[model samples]
Target: MFTGLSAFPLTPVTDHGIDEESFAGLVQRLAAARVDSITALGSTGSYPYLDRAERARAARLAVEHAAATPVIVGIGALRTRDVLELAQDAQDAGASGVLLAPVSYQALTADEVFGLYADVTAELSVPLVVYDNPGTTHFTFTDDLYTRIAELPNVASVKIPGVPADPGAAAERVSALRALLPASVTIGVSGDPLAATGLNAGCHAWYSVVAGTLPEPALAITRAASTGDATAATAESERLQPLWELFARHGSLRVVSAIAETLGLLGHPNLTRPLRGLPDHDRAAVTHVVQQLELH
Candidate 1:
């Protein structure tokens, strides 16, 4: 299971195809920074936007350049068979583990979600991380459902999104989850803005979006929180409040892509069409935040 900061890099695309050079550079940068792990084909990576071939290529490239760093590939698909195939491809590509989310067009029942993970887990060689992002999946997991999934074979961790507005409530929720889940299963939190609160709440890891470009600060926050240094962690989190505000206003995908482009971390910040980059105003806002933070 992945612990600490798992940086999810954006999938830098070009007019032709995946920008291999830029993608590899990003992976190398994360590896150099010594992020706990790297997740390719994540939401930030725009996994759903790309075809299977593109996703497979991205997985291979991530694993290849990740060096000693463990790589976790997102194998989320609407269909069970597609998810299974992607999981197998991730294993073949030398990925350390796979992240699976219950994604569906029609609303999914708890039983269906359980069956999806049960079937996928039975076939996978590596461990699976259960992704619980209701915002996108539209399928929320009750505590009972999470307990059932945690009992599944090879399910190592659960990635829960934090409630940024209510850190106290989020901490209590984390405590409840910790009590419900087995000791072996790690609990990680996503949604970068909520990370400090989540980490302070005793989350084992932070699945961060900003860490994809500016890992130093992200790691600093996580490290402080993980070590029980509330003062330091809160200070670091406050320091990045400007960038987090941008993430809250404009979506993280747009703002982070713009920040990466502005920082020259990626060759092009172009997202797969239909999903566009930040507009001029938002781009200016992100640029100002990045410069103010001296992120570049």
Candidate 2:
């Protein structure tokens, strides 16, 4: 249930709040494309920026609109109490699994992070993903921690921040993780650009940001890589290098918001306060990249 091409859609919020219409449309589009899974409310979904009520509502909309595809809801919160609440909300909303990042203000020790997952996993009826998102969450996981967490009940996957770019290195990294993790706990690669290398190297899943908006191309890469067509998969990823470059420059969240707006998938200025859209010139660059690449 936690493997392959898990698209993380933007929880496109407007001034009025969670744009149910647009967010639902994004989820529906992903379902239609036959993505392996739809992961709502990841970092790309701006989970940190939303309130509990908005997140619960978005989780419901995602499940309601997701059709037959499995829905995995991001349930990360600064506090364990709130994380547990969101996980319950996700289960109530019919999520196949829940993603948890040890969101923090102060630096969290390995024990603290593990304790967070331990506490939440103990309460979960559904499978839980250990969201090792150091970029946003500012906490990294050691292999020792992964082994310990994998032993927890209902711990299903580890969404690693990324893998090495070189195929050999990626393979080595994945193999090492596989050695530590239980057979049931899948390893999913999160960084979109290295998804090809990771999958080709034997990672079980691609927890993607680009796939959330432009699923076709992301699907193309995933399908190619999973089928053992490593060349085609790498080619497809390279083809979308411009988008990846934009992601590197403006961040995937902002760049994808621009793509969504450019494609008319969502209205402009969809992000919340303190998080703004791309500048006009950067937006124009996104438009050009979209047109040049014939995305959508």
lDDT of each: 0.89, 0.93
CA deviation > 4 Å runs, candidate 1: none
Runs of candidate 2 exceeding 4 Å displacement: none
Best prediction by TM-score = 2
Q: Tens digit of lDDT per residue, candidate 2, span 38-140?
A: 9999998999899999999999999999989999999999998999899999999999999999898999998998899899998999998889888898888
How well is each residue in 1-296 modelled by candidate 1, as lDDT tens digits? 46899999999998888988889999999999999999998888989888899999999999999999999999999999999999989999999999999988999999999999999999989998999988788889999999999999999999997755577898888999999998889999998888888888889989888898788999899889878897798899899999888988888888889988998877654689888888888788889988898885
Model 1 CA lDDT for position 147: 94
Query: Model 1: which residue pairs collide?
Result: none
Provide the global lDDT of candidate 2 against the true structure. 0.93
